[model samples]
Target: MQLQILEVILWPKAAGLPPRRVPFEPGKVNVISGASKRGKSSVIPIVDYCLGSRLCAIPAGTIREACAWFGIRVQTSEGEKIFARREPGKQQSTDEMMLLEDSVLDVPTDTPKKNTTRQAVKHLLDRLAGLSNLGFDPEEPRSGFQGRPSFRDTLAFCFQPQNIVANPDVLYFRADTNEHREKVRTIFPYVLGATTAERLAKKWELENLLRELRRKERERAAHDTVSATWLANLQVWVTEARELGLLRGDALEATEETLIVALEKVLAAGEEGNGFSAQGTGASADEYAALQTEESKIVLDLSVARHRLNQITAVRGTVGYYKGALDSQAARLGVSRWLRTLSNDGARCPICDSAMTSSSGELEQLCDALATIENETHTVSMAPPVLDRDLVDVKSKLSLLEDQLKAVRIRKRAIESRSKAIREGEQTSARVARFLGRVEQALELFSARSAPGGLNEELEKLNDSIEDLRKSLSEQQYALKLDAATARVSKDITRIAAKLDVERKDAPARLDIKELTVGVRDDAGREDFLWHLGSGANWLSYHVAAILALHVFFLRQLHSPVPALIIFDQPSQVYFPQRLTRPTAQSEEDDIGDEDVASIRRFFEAMGKLAAHFKGKLQIIVLDHAGPDVWDQLEAVSLAEEWRGNDYLVPKDWLDILE
Candidate 1:
């Protein structure tokens, strides 16, 4: 990827006043130099951040404030050209800040509040430029390679500031200290020759071994979990059976006897009869049958009797009642005549007082005359004639009906006698039938209780056998779980070994961390890289160098189209202490100072050579605060480009104001 940063402007974020801008050309190695507090290091990380490196420690406000101060704009490209610019306040710049191609701006930028220019550019590259392929995705931080970008991957474009004597792992500068001899050997493949590849393979082997062990543990855990469930269920069944006495060894006969006793108790409570005989007595059944037969006879007899009696009673009663009523009527009519005579006299009529009047004049005479006429008319009315002829005829018919009813009563008595005889004869059958029925019913009740419906004991035995088989299966499964875990660990170890290039001779059962080590070469005897190399800086450098060398060689073999630049921050921090050792007066000086210079010179020479080899295809940038002579030596290479210098400056107005 080719990047061109036009200019960066910084506002007064720290002690500095006002704002300033720095500019750089494309594909060039540029150095920014300044004293400690002048924002010299700011340029390195800002550019690094814009390029999608996650190592930057600078806060986002610093970039925003700086942009506001300098009125900055950036021009960049992915598949399409993009220009982005930002200014202070709520409204953000709509125009392209940087132009990848002269004709196209990268469309409209996301609103500033929603997305910052830095984030937008990162996303644009991830999609258009395949930045994700290179293990740097500013678009998404969580996704990508497992570890941070390594030393060899980023050596060319980034470096520490000048005059700082960091270790050679800084990528831009090399340390000559004797303590770093092994590291220098690893990074400079020429120093260790073909053996470096073997060293890398050794380190890979141990890592793979550890990875395999962990994988095995996980697999085992999963298998155990699955198998344990079945085992747990079996245990529960066994526990329940034991609690319910199913596990007791009593014979079926004994079990039946116990069940029979319980059944008898239940039957005694539910049944109506006393002992067997009480229960057996079908006498009630005979009695019910006899009663039913008797009732039928009685109903027939009653029907006949009732029909005859009803006819007779109707004739006799109707005749007598009507005759008496007519007689009474005649008597009432005679009494009524007597009453009329009394009414004719003027002392209030016996039946009605209104007929008597107290008037003394002609009105009283007229009222008395009207009363006498009314009484005479009432007395002269004839009584209704008695219907004696019809009554006499009905009395004759009633007498005939009464004689018929007497004959029916005699017939009913004969039927009742026959019914009673039949009832007495049937009682014996009922008693015998009831005894047999009770015995049959008792057998049915016992059968229902003893039998588990259609589920036979044979089937139950089969179920028990199946349960045993299932328990065995569960045990097998548990064993398989542990075996599978072992197998998984083995597979993982194999895979990681392939990746890490480590190996173990024995088919080990458990993990032995002490067996885990790092080294070069797949040779069987090799164990730890620490033992093979040295301690401190030398040891650390060797591993870092191996890592970088592996990457370079792998890329070359794959024929990948590598970027023109590589960037690395200070890596030697991990090994700086190792570079220090006990100092004898002269031995210390020679080791600490002179030896450091020689090592540094050698490191630069190696960098020059590597750069030359790839110079035909790419550009290289190295950043550092190393001695001036180092750059001078790098410049002597035939393929080297012109060096650019950088420094922080407060504008004249701010300087004057501060002063």
Candidate 2:
């Protein structure tokens, strides 16, 4: 993900004038040193806005008033593309933008129309940078824009403005604000490759699967609880069924879960299975008499139905058997009809030349028998139509009779169950009827829960999926990787810290990822954070070292999405702002001695060395008052433009036109 500004373009508010295209050289520390208020500081905000910052923070004096548009032409790995936007009016920002992508781009003589939007371009950049679209917070990613990393988050590494270049507390760009601060920390691991895109995706999947697994487990557990309750509560139903001959077995002998299974099996079997051996016998006097009378009537009807069904079945079988016999005889006798034709052959058989009269008597008798069988076969086949109708009617009546018998038997069992309760000195009937209704409902529910492809099996499947995803995305595994990666980064911080020679140089320095800043060790090996460290030079050194080291690490990785670019605005500001803190301070720190100049030069000198080390792979842009005398001799540094004397960011001619 190589990104560097080829040019910072400014379209003039005055029409028919060419835009100001300030060229920047790659592979060197490009310098934009100038006097204060020369828009040297404005370069950062221009670049940030063109890169799709939410707010247009370009300074609002001459530069903002003079320019019609703010744009930058950048060289990405995908080749050159120009991003230009109209200057904001009353709004904080504008979605209006001009985007061009190709092997070449033409900077318009006039400011172009609004060809795209800020958010649309940001999404395109996110893809261009190879960023992960997934969020780390698996619980609620949709709640806001905070869950995932954006290409914008990588800008923290790319800029160190005046307020930040030597600041003790805030090291990264926009870290002064809480939103950008917290977001950069969360995305630190991802930006450094400690958390891979695949791992992020898997982590989200695992958490979601675990949620589903827990839901299913709860449901399965509830089924378990319900099944347990069924065993105790269902004993009465089992007794009721056994008494009616709808189920067989001692209800007390069955296991809990198996009782639910038994309920399903017996209900599926209905009254057709062998459950009659356990039917009960007994009742109250009046109710017992009525039960007996009803049982007798049902029994009589069942007997009548059974006799009729048997008669229909017997007749059907007789008709079918008679038809079969007649057909068999008809087949045999038909051969005799053909033989009679042979007897009629004009002079006996062709091969056997015996007299026709000799075979005539036998042929005549055979033909007669054939005629008799054919007639009988037709009559028997005709008997089926009427017999089939009668059979169907009888079977239907039998089914109704059987249902009536089962109901009567169930009522009889109910009476007998009451009789037992009566003998136990209790009264029953209406209560038993209500209990039967409840039992019916429970059995249906139990059947569903204990079914084959039920919640338990689904929960088992979800558990398996969750375990598989956790193999790659476990938190413990990620913690170890993050610790190791931070240690690698800490080594870079310490080496660069030594290179800069900040205060307490003997102590080892480490980047505290939790603190989002660097810390130096004391004699007792207790850490001294940036804010706790004494000198402004010390803070400046640590900040520069940590940022440069992060970029080096980013470049070393095969696919670090952070661009190989760092912008430092006035590294000498710490040396100058110190003077400004005084009541007797001047705008120009004229008392600046050789020592102060040397220390300020050291920061640029270190950046210059890394620029040469990385060569074309790294680029640094410094906006400063540190002029040619400081870095002119440094081979790795080059001045892109010096906005001193009469030169400025917005040309004097543009301001003159406004006047």
Best by lDDT: 2
> What TM-score, over all chains together, does every model reach?
0.31, 0.70
lDDT of each: 0.36, 0.75
Error of 2 at 646 (Å): 1.4
lDDT of 2 by residue, 1-659 (tens): 67888899999989777899898987779998778778888889999998899999887778888998999888876678999988997688898998999887777777778889999889878766777666767677763435867889899999998889888889899989988888888889887777876676666666656766776677667767887666667665777767755577654556766666665554444423222122223224566688688878878887987888788778768978888887788787777766677777745755577767687888899888877776566445434434433554555566566556656766666556444433432213445434444564566455545567555566677778777877766789888888887888888888877767487667788877777888788899898789998888898888888998898888777567788889999887867644322323244545444577677777778889988987588889988887776667886889899886678998989989999
Report the number of the highest-TM-score candidate: 2
lDDT of 1 by residue, 161-267 (tens): 33222232222322223323323322332111222222332233333333434544554455456545533433443343334332344322324445444333333
